[model samples]
Target: MNPKLRRRAAGHGGTFSRQDAVESGYTVSQVRERLRDGRWILLRRGFYAERSDSTDRPPWERETEAHRLAVHAAARALAGSAVVISHQSAVVLHGLPSWGLDLDLVHVTRTDRGHGRILAGTSHHVGELPASAVTSAEGLPATTVARAIIETSCAARYEAAVVLCDSGLRSGLVTRTDLTEMLGQMSGWPGTGTPLAAVAFADERSESVGETRLRVLLDTHGLPAPDLQVPFGTGPNEVVARVDFFFREYQVVVEFDGMLKYRDDAVGAVVREKHREDRLRSAGVLVVRVTWDDLDQPERVVHRIRQAFARAERAGMRRVHP
Candidate 1:
């Protein structure tokens, strides 16, 4: 690639437009030859992504990265237009978790008077994007994190909305107040209630998508709400352990083991977890571990938790302090 094209591609997540390539001293024929020779991967019409080795990453992560590249390409292509990346596309640009969101097409909202339309792989939404709601992510114009969360929540399902809202809150990129204010601006708009409900349901205490989903499961099953990130210790000024969810009434501690459950030393982590569980058991707290797979069996997981409550009662464990 020419120096100018390389710089442009690097700025836009390895993506470059045909015009960029041509201006960078590359002939149209050269661009076609590069694509034909596997040197350039076509992302969309008039756009291309430089192929790089991504074999070490998981398939889903690789796909998400590709979608991000496409988003950048779309942003660059529409630079002169009166639009900013919004909705799920904005969520991706903000580096938030986008669970259950449709990412096949890039999403953009027109700041001017334009009706919503789908052209090729781009979804153009017509909406009011105030100056406060607009921001730049990685040098590309997109919605602010708070506004993006509300837009995503409005466009996605409840669970997906909760996921985005939880992540947005946890990252400190957005606050509950920010979300509430954004929702206030969307009063009477279509699907505004969904985001309102999602914002109310969102908890920054949820540390992962799986944890957020698990919380939703408990609500869906009508299980008693558990305190989040509850701490336990034998003495004051020291916290021996912090659990994901704690049922004070039942003396049960539910630990969510998601992708970030164990970052290193798997064997040592398992041993340490076992020791921790033993300590909790000795302290009159029954442990119930939940995994990503366990979320798929919500009923079974709820049953197991209820059984733990019964076991705790049989053990005669009373209310304990941290």
Candidate 2:
């Protein structure tokens, strides 16, 4: 890659237009050769990103990063246009988790044009983007975090929406007040109900996508609400441990065990977790652990919680510590 072109690409999220390559002294034939030799990746028509050596990354991570580059390329392509990056594309730009959101096409909303069209892997939306909702992500024009979450919630699945909403709030990128204000602006708009519901259900206590999904799973199953990130202590100002979910009424603690957190030292992690659980149990709380796989088996998860409750009832054990 030419030094000038590389610098140009670096400024645009690692993407460059064909015209940029040409201006940097690469001929049309050379550009074709670069693509064929895997030196360049076509992000969109007339847009390319230098191929990255991401063999160490997992497939999902690589795919998400690639989509981010595509978004940058799309932003450059639409430079000077009133179309701001919106929806899932904006989510990526905002560094929010996209979990199950679609990224097949770049989404942009036309703040100037009244009509929108889908073309060349881009979905143009027609809408009036207020100045407040407009912001920049990674130096590219995009919808604000609050706006992006609501916009995505309107079209994405409820679980996915909650994930985004939870993440936005947890990261302090958007607040509940911010979300409520956005909802107010979207009054009477089509597809507002879903965003409204997701905003209402979003909890900043959720620290990860898996935690948010587990929360939604529990609610969807009609189970009793569990206090999130509950702490157990032996005395004032002494925090012994914190569990993911705590059923105060049933004296049960539900912990979400995401495997990623244990990958570096599974045995040590498990031992440490066991000690934590033992301390919680000694404090008279029955513990029930759930994992990524357990979340998929909703019925089993519910059953496990219920069984813990039954055992607590049988033993007459209740929360005895502060």
Candidate 3:
């Protein structure tokens, strides 16, 4: 048990490789003894994680952290001159949002023409990756933000793709113009249309993945495009509230109420939100609330929104001048 190695593993989400142990003056039997004594946990064939007693973190957070360390370890093991991290792994490395991606596998792209293959726990993509499409992050070769988003969206589901694109745009990791140019460069390539559509639909004003996914659901269901982050007030300097989605034609506001909104001060949040809704209602604006669970049923969500829209339409000719 070298203290330096222990510190390194602690910094790396409690994960270390067999090579790390060996280089730190630990023998094979010593590693086995640590595992047997519950001082360490074997994460994979040659990787080990330090045992911890803390249970404050959620299981998913702990698991994802371990997976990230494994990916980095696999990258070090598969070191190659042409290997550049891409796709979901690149997204993780860049600290970008991704939905429904497999974090268990390390994804890399080779800057040469060859067939993509999965070896051990690493997936290698083979294609022509221009120099501009590659960059370095945290001492690892990885795709640039725009290129990473393009590659990721090409392989992700529509909802996932749109979420990633929106996140990239919102974070300023990639620009809409850059994504559009990347789409043009990827034209005629396999799986380009989906990313193209994602880029076209992406909006930086979307504050979270839930909002982006909700927008996608609305568009997919043929609902009229609602103005995002619409401010409600009688005058420019007297802004009363800014809403998630606003349909001026129907005088409706659709909000995606993510769990985080109430996770911290539930009572205070409820009071503030209730007052906001009341103010909007008093202004003759119908308010519709959606949650993550509601997103699971797109049809039902759209139906409820449509009902709200109809109610607003039939409730006389009152309007709130924004």
Q: Global lDDT of each model?
A: 0.87, 0.89, 0.81
lDDT of 1 by residue, 270-312 (tens): 8988898888776668899999889989999999998998888
lDDT of 3 by residue, 196-283 (tens): 9888888999998889989999999999899999888755477668899998788889989987678679999999999888877776
Winner on lDDT between 2 and 3 is 2
Candidate numbers sorted by lDDT from highest down: 2, 1, 3
The best candidate in terms of TM-score: 2
Model 2 C-alpha lDDT per residue in residues 182-260, reported as the tens digit of each score: 9998888878888898999999999999899999989998988999998897677877798889989888999999877
TM-score of each: 0.90, 0.91, 0.87
Query: Where is the poorest 10-residue window by lDDT in model 1?
Result: 258-267
- Report the Cα RMSD per candidate: 2.7, 2.5, 3.2
User: lDDT (0-100) at residue 152 of candidate 3?
Assistant: 79
Write down the TM-score for model 3.
0.87
Residue 211 lDDT in model 2? 90
Off by more than 4 A, model 3:
1-3, 10-15, 22-30, 33-44, 51-64, 112-115, 234-237, 317-322
Error in Å for residue 192 of model 1: 1.6
Off by over 4 Å in 2: 1-3, 25-27, 55-60, 234-238, 318-322
